[model samples]
Target: MIFMHIFSSLCVRTLTNRAHAIGDELAALFLLANVCLMVMPAAVRADETTGTARIELLHLWRTPGEQAALHVFRDALSDPSMAWFDTPVQGGATGVRKQLSDLLAAEAQPNIIQWIPSEELNQLFDLGVFRTVDTVDEDFADKLLPEIREVAETDGVLRVLPVGIHTYDFMAYNRQLFERLGIELPTSWESYLALGPLLAESGVPLLSVSDENWQLTAMYRTLMISEFSKEEVLSMARGEADLETYRNRFETTFEILFELRRFAAPDREDLRWEETVARVERGEALSILLGDYIVAAFDDPDKLICARSPQSSYIPWGFDSFVFTHVDDPVLLQGQTRFAKAASDIDNIVNYVMHKGGLPVISGVTPDQLDRCNADTLVAWQKRPLLWEGLLQGKNRIMAMNAVIVTIWRDETITPAQAAERVIDAMSRP
Candidate 1:
């Protein structure tokens, strides 16, 4: 049966690139027969085996260090007591999406796969394709941070597990530049905005930003928090909040953004995250709003400095996690649970997050372990209420409004009020 399956798969592969010919119908019949004879029997046997559960993982980042950590994860699963089956596939962003589509179409979908922030997981949950871990293990829910749990839960059911938390829209500045200018670190939006004219006078560009819309989205989300509470932000996400409230805050934010735009470089729109970071590192730009993952770009710690965007104080920091999809086999479920626990173990979790230059969601790391982190950046992750206040109060919203207003200001498209109105318009969009 296995031989027939291999033979049929080969014929299918060959026919895949060929145009339909006279023998096409016969070839199709042969392929169909082989699939029934070979694939079905193997699937039945796999179900009967019962002891080992198979899982496939898809991940976005395929850096060398991440690949190494996956190797460790694979080795951990190989333990005799584990009763696990696992495969790891690494790909670029586009590849990950394609692979996910293929998995959803498989005859027997994997018991586990990587999940992103999208409607796809919700769709899968609605299809009953994923098992609810929250139902099976109450302890799992208890182990998560409240914010992490909140993000993982969809409609009162847990759909994913958070692995770590990172603030991608936080701002970073060159310590040397601030020192040279004799300017103190700006703590409030008022103080941050005040730098615009000073930068203009010095002929130094004050801000550098990327061209990516998602980065803009991250910046906007951070800004939204300044205008709304955590609950309000979630409400907005659920389509329950008033768009006008969000728009009003965005208007205030755009005014500041337009002012900052005067100090940006001429070719700023052509720059990307890496290029902006390079500018900051080279002292060409004084500050940038970037994700915490920027630590991954710099090899020498001395050349760079980082701080949480004053705006990030509005949201709790959290990371993406792997959630096991639902499976019918009880043994497989058990194995998956065990694997999840092992994955969350402090030793492994801390090492993994630290290596990636992000904060661990799980709480077991020692102070010494944290001290070993190469970068000396201040992480602005705080508890819930303050986080919400920062977001809803207009502090963070300015950052997003600033991104667009600044661009317009640079292009001479409109006055600050008009730029602010544009930001309000953008935020008001669905």
Candidate 2:
């Protein structure tokens, strides 16, 4: 089973990377594709003797907490007539998308997959990647949260199975560290900066962040969200902002992002989000500003202290979901329907949220100890803005923006004003 995943991803990457090169590379790619992962069929029949279907999965879940939550999901859908196999992809949605494309190009079909549910998700169904309705439980669509129920919905039919939900902007800290230093949560940018000297004297860092684009952007974007109203942020994202608006919006947050450098954990430019979470859990840093999903990463609940970022008044939410490739086999289709029903079951979702760290889509879910911070805050947080980070479907130059953000932290010459200028320049490009 382990050997099945190896050839497909590597073979696809090798062929794709060289396709743009001239002459010899083109010839090599043509020859290589013949012997590569195309030979690994996406769908395989069940063992005749056992009559158990093999449900292979391609997903982006790898962290300790996500893995644990995935196990719980598998258990809920487990059946004697089926078995689960994993083909984990390290490169997140982009990687999974690329590999899935290569497999499909080769006419191989990997049916079950993890996808970020958004408006664009319907594109998959439109492209003949999968279909809904008949594949899901009759009541599955009605069971989802209204916001989730509408995502990836084409016409009156939903195209994807909503799995887990979360907001990435929330901050979680070490309670013991804050108490030891007598530090209070910052209500505004000024207050956050005022704590600098206190944190400096105590020789503890203020927060942890990573250079990974999404991780850095979530932190950067949240700070932006704190500065702007929800309507303004959504408006800017929609490209309604004029030149001065971009300048004002970006510069204000970049200034705070620049100041935040003095408080960030040292030498964390290379850290992954999970590693940063561990830093806070170890009390090595005072806090970590990341998605609330990281709650399960901490072994002890006593060490966790949760808060929204400075002036964060909105609760931005998004759902993680699974979408299937069309399958004609009755047995496979039955398995898909079973999995969909299990995933949307209110009780199953509540239990899954225990390890997954977000609210169930339906109501009446009481906040367990870890979820109290995110769940309890929803009442007072007021505006429930659609989450902004992953929802952007390349609307702006993300790589260009990410490069400027990295330089803003590592190179002081790239001043906040200049970062604002460059960020606008990035945003302006096609």
Candidate 3:
């Protein structure tokens, strides 16, 4: 009886040990499964990493010198820590509207593309296509020029990162011609008009305007700045003011544009901005009302002299910046944030723009970098107020300013007052 009792006890003990062992094995398997599920995707992404990025760039075929500025960006991305996974796929300049349409259609778009104006940015944001970069390093914003920093943001959100700072409404001159002709630089619209006949008499076109309507439009905005306060302009654009008020301003600016046209080259209707700049460079035209980017457009930097527009009190006419679309992809969003932060860094901004013969938007560039540029020209840009003068302002009235100028220049059928009326009509379009 005693032996039987001991055997029963041993059997019970064995069954308990077996049950505990099974539970241990099951727990181990569950933990392993959880880790595999959690970590596999990240491992896969890691393996797929190709150190080089494939980026598609869309920009106008400007001067070869301007095109070559991409090297500075490419080199900046070569740092190991930044780990850019892009390789540039260069494409010819398509119209801004067309490019946005195609970007929406592509299954996988380029990681980065040059941004269009602010109006287009609004449309892009509505589509939920762009990724917002929130993890930008604190120092990034500090590197940008105050104007660039202001323009880089929209509704308090930082959109595009500016690759360079540009002042679009400034004028360029042939120093030798101005000196030979013994003409002092014009200081105001009135002064400029005073010299127009003298310039025409010397057989040099007073201004070389491109047939491209945008250039003519830019001139109108510069003139508007002189005539109206910034608040008045913004209010008019937002439809807070009546057409009569806007028309009055528009007509005033148009009248000046018309008067300036008399001194423009006869073939101006056929000339593009590049050709116009080239004519000025060759001394066929005494001056051109263009932006600082003209310095990059010239093959020999020494041949050009850039200054704030003598006619507009030296206020800058336009600013270029980057905007991100509302993107949902975590990986892409991370990458863009990193890129934006690096690009906006003060040192990088200075390096990129200065190398391209552009002014640094960020302050504190070393003397060595500034030494490479035309010192006086850089100083002039530093003192100017950057303007955002493109059709991107989303004001129909403002856009018409360009159309009116182009139509008048081309057909020679409309008086300046009539052109101003047409501009008011266009701006009033729903």
Candidate 4:
């Protein structure tokens, strides 16, 4: 099996890197494809009789921790007593998408493909191109977080094995500073606003925010989602909700943003995200509202404490998964099942979270040795309802509207009512 995996990888690399090496490269690939067809049938027959199989894994990542998690899985697959050989074909997000596209079109099919859930997830499932989790292992289906498991399903069938749930909307603050100043973390948007005058009097900002369009846009989007439930947000986005119905909420959300602006750092526009967080780290600011990446940024883990924004009811998150692709060979099918099960096991779960810095989706697999902020994040993940990322589309549209709304509202160029109208107008665009 190992020999077969090495040979197959060499064939793929050769085909990829040497496509233009000869004028008849296309003809050569056609011949090679024919050779593969001839060889696979014999190999499948051999594997069935010998009880051995080989599978390929297409792994995706954006961080070093994720890369480390991939290595953990690879090491598990390398167990000496195992009957199958697994090889990892690696790439970043864009490369993973290209690989999945090719595999879905049946141009190539690795045994496992890792990716985030997207709008096209159900379409792919409906085509019968991937295996459901029930087909993999019934016990495995029982191990995932309820919300994470729910989102992985299509028509009540599980289609993906989740790796981690990574939340993006969170606030990190200095616990010591807050304790010293005798202020509690805000429990709602109103409480957040009430902190403004106190923060101003202390010469510390209520929040450390950046003027980076995406940063502000992400903050606004969270506030928008929190101001309304996911269902309401989606309805308003689809133009199903009348402007008059949501106008008050939109106005309130904008008011929160404007009020925070008054207490923000004077040079916030010139500060990078790291610099903005540094203010909170140094106790120069009360808090910073951003993504979970801040959990890993603290030099002294105990110095930071994180919580979901006061307005957030369900934490909006992104996740990674190992999605199984369909294969007819029984040995290869069994190998794929084992791969999925191995990924969901407790040891891998903890290692992935500890190394990868994301919340593990399986229950009872707490990561060890986390600093205060990361521990808080893990607790929040377990306690809060999960809203998977990418549910909110039209980011460029949101960013554009937010830029106009923030600029005009801050400068008193538009009334909150008119700003609400502009928001609805932006949503209505094609």
Query: Pick by lDDT: which candidate is best?
Result: 2
Q: Each model's C-alpha lDDT? A: 0.55, 0.68, 0.58, 0.65
- Candidate 1 per-residue lDDT over residues 1-430, each given as its tens digit: 6887676566444433331232223333323333433333222324444355544455755544445545555565675545444444543333454454444333344666655443344544554545655533456566666756655776666677656556554666777888888887777667876887787787778887654554544554555455556666655544566656655565665555555555665576645555666787788878886666555554443555565555444543435567675455665566667667566565666666655566666543444565332223222343334332222222333334444633554456676456556765655554
Error of 1 at 245 (Å): 5.2
The alpha-carbon lDDT assigned to residue 356 of candidate 2 equals 72
Candidate 2: tens digits of C-alpha lDDT, residues 1-430 = 5675677667666666654343222234434655663354544544422534545578887887788877776887667777677677866676676666555445454667888765455544555556674555667677666777767456777677776777766888788988887777778878977876788778888877777766777688778777777676656566776646668768788888887877888888668778988989888788887777777677765688777777775666677778887766665666676677677777777777777776666644444432566565444333455553445554455445665676666777687788888888876776
lDDT of 3 by residue, 261-337 (tens): 87887776656666778888888888887666666666665665555665454444344444454334455555566
Q: How many residue pairs clash in all the candidates, one count each?
A: 21, 0, 17, 1
Compose the digit string of candidate 4's lDDT tens values, residues 1-430.
Answer: 7867665666555545444353222334434544443333223332333555455677655344446667777677775434643334433444565555444323356667776775556655655546676554567667777777777866767788887767877888787778888988788878877887887887877788877655676677777757888777656545576657877888878777777777777676645566777788888888888777654445554677678788678777877787877677666676776677678776776667665555777766553545455577787777776666655543444434665654543464566666677776775575
Q: After superposition, how far is residue 295 of candidate 3 from its true place, in Å?
A: 2.1
lDDT of 4: 0.65
Worst 10 residues of 2 by lDDT: 20-29
The global Cα lDDT (0 to 1) of model 1 is 0.55
RMSD of each: 9.1, 5.9, 16.9, 8.8
Can you give the TM-score per candidate against the true fold? 0.65, 0.84, 0.73, 0.65
Which residue window of length 10 is worst by lDDT in model 4? Answer: 40-49
How many clashes would you count in candidate 2? 0
